[model samples]
Target: MLYQNFSKTPVLAAAATSLLLLLLLSSTAHAEAPMAANEATEVVISASRIEMARESSGSAITVLDSDYLEQNQVQVVSDVLRDVPGVAVSRTGGAGAPTQVRIRGAEANQTLVLIDGIEVNDVASGSEFNFAHLMNLEVERIEVLRGAQSALWGSDAMGGVINIVTKRGKGSLNGKITVEGGSYDTHQETLAINAGTDDYHYALSGTLLNTNGISAASEERGNREKDGYKNATINLKSGIDLLDNLSMDLVVRHVKSDVDTDSFLGGVGAVDSDDNTETEQTSGKVSAKLDLLDEQWHHRLSFSANDTDNTFFTAGTESYNSQGYKQKYEYQTDLFLYSSLTNSDDLEHRFTFAAEHEEEEFYNKGFSTIDRDMDVSGYVVEYGANIDDRYYATVAGRRDINSLFQNANTYRLTFAGWVTDSVRLHTSKGKGIKNPTLFELFGSTPDYTGNADLRPEENSTWDVGTEYHFNALDGYVDLTYFHTDVTNLITGSGQTSVNMPSDAKIKGVELSLVLRPSDNTRLNSSYTYTDSNDGNGNELVRRPEHVASINGSYLFSNDQTRLTTGVQYNGKQDDIEYDANWNTSTVTLSDYTLVNVALTHQLNKHIELFGRVDNLLNEEYEEVLTYGTKGINGMVGITITGSL
Candidate 1:
């Protein structure tokens, strides 16, 4: 009954049709030469906090490498992840507005975000990360792991995890400079520097962005003032090879941005509220790693802190600010139990153990300082193995003890194996937990009081998928099914915040296909279908039932020149609308599609030119009910790069 509004045709039909088109496109290709070997798979760290190949991880994950980011001319982190499977991104306005991201129909706060292995979710802001304020500066790669990861990442990981890795110097004397400008009076500039040798490394980068000529409120809402935004960011990553078996690393990131936002209530004879918002966030991490026993054992100790302050200035006397602080200490070790169990090269075993302590605090500007603090201690253990040549398995467990609430335990088990030489299967089941945020637990006023006896949220998740590789076409296809049941959902009514008695159930299917018929051409298609309910016979807000995307790229003239085109479709869904009388109504937001194109050319090894256009059709649609979205925008830039 969840999908009562959808058509009689099953959603899988759409995926089948798309795959047929890709197959037809591949059939017409007759290669003049043998296709090149598949690119080497990059290592990902979010799956288990250890480097591993994606094929053997036994989890659903997506990685965007530096090369792919440069090819698409991506500047913002959200822009690169907007169309990923089982993920939905919505924002209130342009580049600097508040943005919300949901995974697999989970709430925004259910996902955990990490920058270089340091948690960045604001404890005072409902435990969510603002994607609009995150720039892709000096980023080497991004790893998105879907489904409940509480067993590995703890709280705020009930939905998934997003891990970002920054670039590090690899050789002596290397750098890049980029400048870009386009529609909406927008402009950007970035500079990067790196230098070192195998014994030491260091990198520094900075970026500036400014944009004007867009209203925070939609044109349909009859707003007329142009809202502007400004952003500045700096990043640093340095490391020293102190000894033969030990190293020290330091990473720092800082971002400051200001934006004109909208805080309006729509009804009869309503007016939009224009306001100015500013935010500053800084984070630092220092870690030391040591190898012992002939490289059979490894240990890492780290300390990190993330600080944030935000302000909102309104037209009248109503204004507010919040300051959030977090600190963490962690230690982890890895032991290679067995590197060679048999004569073959496919047998291995690894064991991991970890411990962490974290503290959080928050304050408010207008009201008296809440002065609330809480500490949590967590422990984790994991085992992974590739048994024989046909099977890989991972088992993990974690326990958390909070000073304010009761203890929690979560576990996960996963398996991946080959049914045939060309076909493989994967499945996983896990439990998840999320403790209440600081503000939700202690920042209530006299009229709206916080519940002292609140309980942590909990969930159970399971997923199964299969992958098939077509050697002739040099392509692959993947399909997965997932389900989740969540309980102890917290809800805030007008007067107080409390845990709701009802539960939520969500399920979905994800499909992805890729084909490379020739050395110069590639095709990709992906689709997702989700159905969720909140136990009140109402659909979850902002959760679309259908989403799909298509991508194609071609190399022209030479290998140095390439063109990429893509389209994304988001289906209609229901959202809650509150009237002036405090009555709620469910409304249907129309479906919409986005088109994008990008091109890159290399004049020589040291210089390259790139350009991209987003929302090619300029489709005017709202991701959030009354929020305005950027119409047509483009950027053209040139890059100079080299290593000596």
Candidate 2:
């Protein structure tokens, strides 16, 4: 039933036209050549909890820099993740609606998210982070590492890791202010300031957003009510040098939001109602670092805490509330075991050791009062070696002791080597474990129950990939194949949760290309094919079988103006449908494509004008079964930059 009418002719034609125009305009332009394999030295931090050369790491990682984020001009963080190779994003409705991100067909909670080194997952809501309230106002960089990573991170790392690093102050005092307004009576304002010197640095940023959104239910179904949302966020980052060899850093963030929601009926799905949700999130982290022995030995100690409160209202009265609190303490050390440099060869060996303790508490108040808490202690060790800058290997192991579940031990191995001057091969194998969330073990509601006997899910994954660098084309191509097998799959049986009797399997292929055809033009494209099956040989819900995207940018007019365009395609997928009696059955969602364009012009050194059109094609689509999506819409704004 799926893919019967799927067509790619329209999207391919559009992409071809755009590329032709780019080539025609850049025929005579001259620019510096792209960096070669040996000359490139980008560092990735999330793969090993420390900075390592991207070319030497075996893990698949996608790094989005500040420039890329600025060019996209997206307000929500999840919008940017859609361009990553293995990520899938689903939003129930418009902006501020509940959103979920899955990597490689894994469950939403299986992915680990980190912001400024702090874990912000909600312990009371199945240990998953909601992307509805996560804005991209102060992000400097994002690192997406895909694969099983429990050997490095304790839990919730079966799918992958998304690490976001915020901007830090540097140089003289500088700041920026922005204001924008768009369709659906939407408006946003942002302010940021930063100042730093050799010994001290700090940055502060804030954003406010308000939108009169569309209906959460499908408009075709005759829903006419307009839901609204409002959000405010503030962030601060600072660091100070206590001594020549010691330093300390601090990070704090606060977010408050309120969003109107709709009710869900058994047969009718989403229906208009005077329902809403209010959420407050606060998180902070402090860390100290010390270096000795000619800066070869490093040690760090850190403490982090996160608190979240959510209140759900029915009609005009508050019906339920939940709170989640988490605290973590950790210490880690890195040592250089050996190092040697020669004209012909360079070699190095390193070791890392870490210990962590974490505590979580969940509380819910409604018809039934529930309170639960859990603690975990973990230790990890890793060794890495690089031979002649062409061969790399890493081995790691971890031991975790849980207060409510069985103890777990995990391990990982990776290797990367250059097979030729223009080709490189990389592979990794790892094991991961995710403990049952507090809510799944003790939570109780009118429609659902919890089972304390549920077991933790376990996964084993492996991936092999190769990279080819084209010197003549000034581009690179990457292809990878990945597979994962998961045992002890957790699912809901009637009203309570239970472990599946069979195992789940997932396999996928990813291909990506990047080309700097000209100094003034850049192009990027990616395609993914996924085949996922549940224990009972049924396709997983919301996991599309095929996805593709193409994005390009062109700069002209004395390098003062830029034009960018992008297109994304999502193939047909399955979703669960409920009848009047709450019986569930599978339904297929039609495939759709979306087009977007953005432009920016620099008026001067201090003032800039920017605008973007989303859903330019105005194609009707649905990411979720009954969720409504916005049509063609556009927004325009101005930015002012100056020194404080």
TM-score of each: 0.90, 0.92
* Residues forming the 10-long window of minimal summed lDDT in candidate 1: 29-38
Residues 1-644 of candidate 2: C-alpha lDDT, one tens digit per residue:
11112132222333344335434533432232211235354567778888787778899887777777788787899987888888888998887899999888888889889999999888867889999999997898888888899999878887889888999999899999999999999999999999999999999999999999988877867888998999999999999999999999999999999998888887878888898999999999999998755556677878889999989899879988888898877777766544447777756666677777788898988678999889887888898887877898999999998989889999989998999988989999999999998888887665567788889999999999999988776777899999999998887665578888899999999898887778888888888888988889988889998988888888885898999898988899998787877677889999999898999999999998999999999988889988888889889999999998
Clashes of each: 0, 0
RMSD of each: 12.0, 12.5
Give the winner by lDDT: 2
Cα error, residue 489 of model 2, in Å, equals 1.5
Please estimate how well model 2 matches the true structure, expressed as its whole-model Cα lDDT. Answer: 0.84
Give the Å error, residue 64, model 2.
1.1
Best by TM-score: 2
lDDT over C-alpha atoms for residue 643 of model 1:
73
